[model samples]
Target: MGVLFYGSAEHAIEIDDVALAHLKVVIATKLRRNESFTLSWMHDSGQPLGRSTIWLHPSIELRFAFEEPTPPPLDPAKIQAYANSANTSGGILVPEEHILGSSRGVVLTA
Candidate 1:
């Protein structure tokens, strides 16, 4: 599992390492262009049976930490899917499962 530390140092979201890798690419691209967007995802089991969304901006303190020292290979399809979603008004909505192994499918919101 990888941790996405956004804003507050204590605020962290645990995600699959591979999924975070794909998302990192898309997020970096958007932030490099000074674009701000939202990222939404379904809550994990044991949590509230709902979803959550967060605003992402270049100025915000963002950090991604992986349990593995090396990052796994990134999938272009997944990256494209994330980028496509991030380009939308609703930004990127991640599946509760790992993107590379999940069947939930990529959903883009306008």
Candidate 2:
């Protein structure tokens, strides 16, 4: 799992590294353009219950930490899809498979 330390207070949000990497790109792009959006993800057993959403803005500090030293290879098509979805009212939805123990590492859809 990866940790996204968000804002000045550094509230940590745990996410899958691969998924976080994809989100990093889209998030950077949006923030660069001064766009704000919410990132929603389903909670795994470790979390309390239900899903969580965070509003991202350029002014806020964000950090991504991965367990693996090296970054994962990202798919352009998938990134584009994520970016497209982010532009919508719902923003970006982190797929269940990306979360730990949600899909047993088998990707059905994102």
Candidate 3:
């Protein structure tokens, strides 16, 4: 299964290719100016099943926020699929909950 990462607050930047590029630009510029901030995410295990970390720059206080206007409502069928595939791993397999989140860290696909 794939793990999606979303910012913890509404309006946080979503880390897509375009946004990541923007992040790089912002980081480079901010670092040049000496700034710091944090970046964090939760794995898609639906529990406290993975590690979360944050990053900071000298001049950028990056607050992890949810770029999505609202988290998509949970789907029961997808939950069943996730439960069925919980034990499998490897390859890019993104469950329904992550269709709109970042596509990085995809390992196992069904």
Candidate 4:
């Protein structure tokens, strides 16, 4: 499992390492261009039993932590799909497998 620390360490969101890897690519690409967008996901478990969305911007601190020391390989198809959603007005929705139905490890802090 990987953790995505957004804003502060206390606000860490746990996610699969592979999924986080893909998210990192998409997020990095958008922030590199100074773009801000919403990242939405459905919370099937946890305190919130519904959907959640976060505003991702260059100003906000974001970190991706993986259980493994080495980073997983990147999938171009996944990156493209994520980038496409992120570019849309609605922004990017996480649980990326839903976007590409396809299928990693590392602690990448950004």
lDDT of 1: 0.78
Rank all candidate structures by their TM-score, best first, as comma-separated numbers. 1, 2, 4, 3
After TM-score superposition, the amount by which residue 87's alpha carbon in candidate 2 deviates from its true location, in angstroms, is 0.4
Q: Where in model 3 is the C-alpha error above 4 Å? A: 1-15, 44-51, 58-110
Model 3 Cα lDDT, one tens digit per residue, 48-92: 456344444453344423334544444455444433332233211
Model 2 TM-score? 0.81
Give the higher-TM-score candidate: 1 or 3.
Answer: 1
What would the per-residue lDDT of candidate 2 be over residues 12-37, giving only the tens digit for each residue?
67666777788789999999999999
Clashing pairs in 2: none
Worst 10 residues of 2 by lDDT: 101-110
What lDDT, from 0 to 1, does candidate 4 have? 0.72
The segments of candidate 4 whose C-alpha lies over 4 angstroms from its true place after superposition are: 95-110
Number of backbone collisions per candidate, in order?
0, 0, 25, 0
For candidate 3, what is the total of clashing residue pairs?
25
Q: Rank the candidates by lDDT, best first.
A: 1, 2, 4, 3
Better of 2 and 4 by lDDT: 2
Tens-digit per-residue lDDT, 39-90, candidate 1: 9987554454567789999999999888789979888988999999999999
lDDT of each: 0.78, 0.76, 0.37, 0.72
The true-versus-predicted C-alpha distance at residue 31 of model 2, in Å, is: 0.5
